[model samples]
Target: MNEQQRVMQIFQAYREVNQAFFQVMAKVAQKHGLTPLQLIVLRILKEFPDIKLMELSDKLNLGNSTTSGIVDRMVKAGIITRERTESDRRAMTLKLSDKGTTLWEESNDMRLMLLRPLLGLSEEDQQQFHRIQTEILTILKTIKGDVLHD
Candidate 1:
C-alpha cells in the first residue's frame, strides 16, 4: 500500500477501536441506569460541585442547549441539585444530591470491576499502557488545539 493508504487504514482502525470502547461504555452505563453522557456529567459534578452551567458546558465541550438539557434531566431524576451561590445569590452551581453520590459510587464500583483484569496486568505493562495512552491523548489534544490544555 502507498503511505497515504497505510495512514488511512491506521486511522480507520483507531476510529473503530474508539467506537467499540464507547459502545461498551454505553452498555455499561445503560445497565447502571444512566447514559454515558449523564455518567460523565455526574463524574464531572462530583469533582467540581460548584461548577456553573457555562463552565460545565465548556468543560464538557458541549453546546449550552445540550448541557442544559442534560442538566434538566439529571435534576428531574434527582441525581443533581442546582443551587444559587450564597455570595452571588443569583449565580447557580451544580451539585450532586445524596442519590447522585450513591449512583456515582455504584457506577465507580462497576467500572472498577470491569477494569480489574486490565489492572491485573504486569506493573510494567500497566505503566506502558498508561504512558502510551497519555502520549496518544497529548497528540490528539495538540492536533485539536495549540497548547493541548485538555
Candidate 2:
C-alpha cells in the first residue's frame, strides 16, 4: 500500500478500537443501571466536586439543556444532588450524592477492569504500555483542546 493508504489504515484501526472500547463501556454502564453519559457525569463530579451546570456542560462539550436533562435524571435516580450556592442562590450546582459516590466507585472499578490485564504484563512491557497510553492520551487531549493546565 502507498504511504497515504497505510496512514489511513492506521486511523481506521484506531477508530475501530475506540468504538469497541466505548461499546464495552456502554454495556458495563448499562449493567450497572446507568447510561454511559451518566457514568461519566458521576466520574467528573468525583473529580470536580460541586461543579455548576454551565461548567459541567463546558467540560463535557454538551449543551446546557442536554446536560440539565442528564442531571435531572441522575437526581431522580438519587445519584446526584443539585444545590444552590450562597453567592448565587438562584443558580444550582452539581454534586455526587452518597449513593452517587458509591456508584462512581463501583463503575470506576468496572472501567479499570477493561485494562486490568495490562498490569499483569512483564515489567518492561507494563512500563511501555503505560508510556504509550500516556502519550496517546496527551495527543488526544491536545487535539481536543483539553490540554492539562497544571
Candidate 3:
C-alpha cells in the first residue's frame, strides 16, 4: 500500500477507537441520568471548578443562549449550579454541585474499572504509554499545524 492508503487506514482505526470511547462514555453518563453533552459539561466544570458562562460557551463552540439553556437544565437536574456575582448579578458563573461532583467521581471510577487490566502493565510500559499519550495530546491541541511557524 502507498503512504496515503496507510494514513487512511490509521485514521479509520482512530475513528473507530473514538467512536467506541464515546459509546462507553455515553453509557456511563446515561447510568447517571445525563446525556453525553451534559456529562461533558460536568467534566469540564469539574476540571476548572468555576467558569463564566461565556467562557464555557466558547470552549464548547456553543452560543451563549445555548449554554444558558444547558446550564438551566443541569441546575434543574441538581447536577450543576449557576451563581451570580454579588457585585454584578448579571454576570453568571457555573460550577458542579455536590451531586455533580459525585457523579463525576463515579464516572472516573468506572473509567478506572474499564482500564484496570490495561493499567496492570509493568511500570516501564506504563510510563511509555503515558509519554505517548502526552505527545498525542500536545499534537492534537496545536492550531491547524501552526502553518506560520513552518
The numbered model that scores best in TM-score is 1
Instruction: Name the candidate, 2 or 3, with the larger lDDT value.
Output: 2
Per-residue lDDT tens digits for candidate 3, residues 1-150, read 999999698679779978988988888888878888888898789888779988998888999999899999999989998888787889878899999999999987886677678767999998997797687678766845786567
lDDT of each: 0.89, 0.89, 0.86
Residue pair clashes in candidate 2: none
Superposed Cα deviation of residue 84, candidate 2 (Å): 0.2
Q: What is the lDDT of residue 64 in candidate 2?
A: 96
Q: TM-score of predicted model 1? A: 0.83
lDDT of 2 at 81: 98
Decreasing TM-score order of the candidates: 1, 2, 3
Candidate 1 per-residue lDDT over residues 1-150, each given as its tens digit: 999999798689889978977877787689879999998998999999889999999999999899999999999999999999999988999999999999999887887777577667899998997797788788888788965555
Error in Å for residue 12 of model 3: 1.1
Candidate 3 weakest ten by summed lDDT: 140-149
Candidate 1: give the clashing pairs.
none
TM-score of each: 0.83, 0.80, 0.79
Model 1: how far residue 91 lies from native, Å: 0.6
Off by over 4 Å in 2: 120-150
Q: Alpha-carbon error at 1 in model 2, in Å?
A: 2.4
